[model samples]
Target: MNINLNINNKIYNLQVDVDEPLLKTLRTLGFKSVKSACETSNCGLCTVLIDDLPHLSCTILSVQCESKKIVTLEGLSEEVKIIGDFIAEEGADQCGFCSSGFIVNVISLKRLYPDIRDELFIKNYLSGNLCRCTGYEGQMRAVRKYLEV
Candidate 1:
């Protein structure tokens, strides 16, 4: 099937498999920052923003995203410096495997809930994006600082 995808502020017209997951199609299109770890959607590593909301690319069909606006880590490169610096300063990043998805979710949090002032709310919001390192304390700290709460 042929589809048009609006990703990272750019439109792409291409032929895609009917059942192809957005993850595969996006990576194939050179959006390497949208990493894939668990294709079953358990990891949240393949998360991407669809129309300003985060969704697991591994479970979303490319065809279903035809009219949606998708955003990936590369799409939000402008934020990486600030958020990335915070994570690094707080020592929240380790192994770096979950950084992309976690950061994307953080971006969503900042955009979705701008009034957020509690760490618990931040933790609850980003619970889906898992990390095998840092035990989340540092991450929470970084997020708090990022949100200035």
Candidate 2:
């Protein structure tokens, strides 16, 4: 199937298998940041913003995303740079494998709830993303700093 995908603010028309996961298609197209740690959607490493909502790319079909506005971390808005900066300053990006997905999801959360500052709420919202390193303390600090700003 030939599908048109608006990814990272650019339009891509590519031929893909009907059942191909969006993660594979994106990666094949050189969007290497869309990691695929867990193909079953258990890990949030494949998360992407589809029409402004975060969705697991590994579990979504390429055909299903035809014509949708898909935003990867590379396409993140400039306004959300604070989140990235905070993460870096806090040294939260361990292994760096999950950073893209974490940052993308954080951008979605911040856009959805600009005034959300509760630690529990942030933790609960980001629970889907699992990072074995850093113990999540640094990531939590980054989120708190970003929200407080």
Give the top-scoring candidate (TM-score): 1
Model 1 ranges with Cα > 4 A deviation: none
- Over 51-99, each residue of candidate 2 has an lDDT whose tens digit, in order, gives 9999999999999998899988778758458888899999998788988
Worst 10 residues of 1 by lDDT: 140-149
What do the candidate models score in CA lDDT, each in turn? 0.90, 0.88
Residue 62 alpha-carbon offset, candidate 2, angstroms: 0.6
Judging by lDDT against the true structure, name the best candidate: 1
Each prediction's TM-score against the native?
0.96, 0.94
Q: How much does each candidate deviate from the true structure in C-alpha RMSD? A: 1.2, 1.3
lDDT of 2 at 125: 94
Candidate 1 at residue 82, lDDT?
81
Across residues 46-66, which tens digit of lDDT does each residue of candidate 1 receive?
889999999999999999998
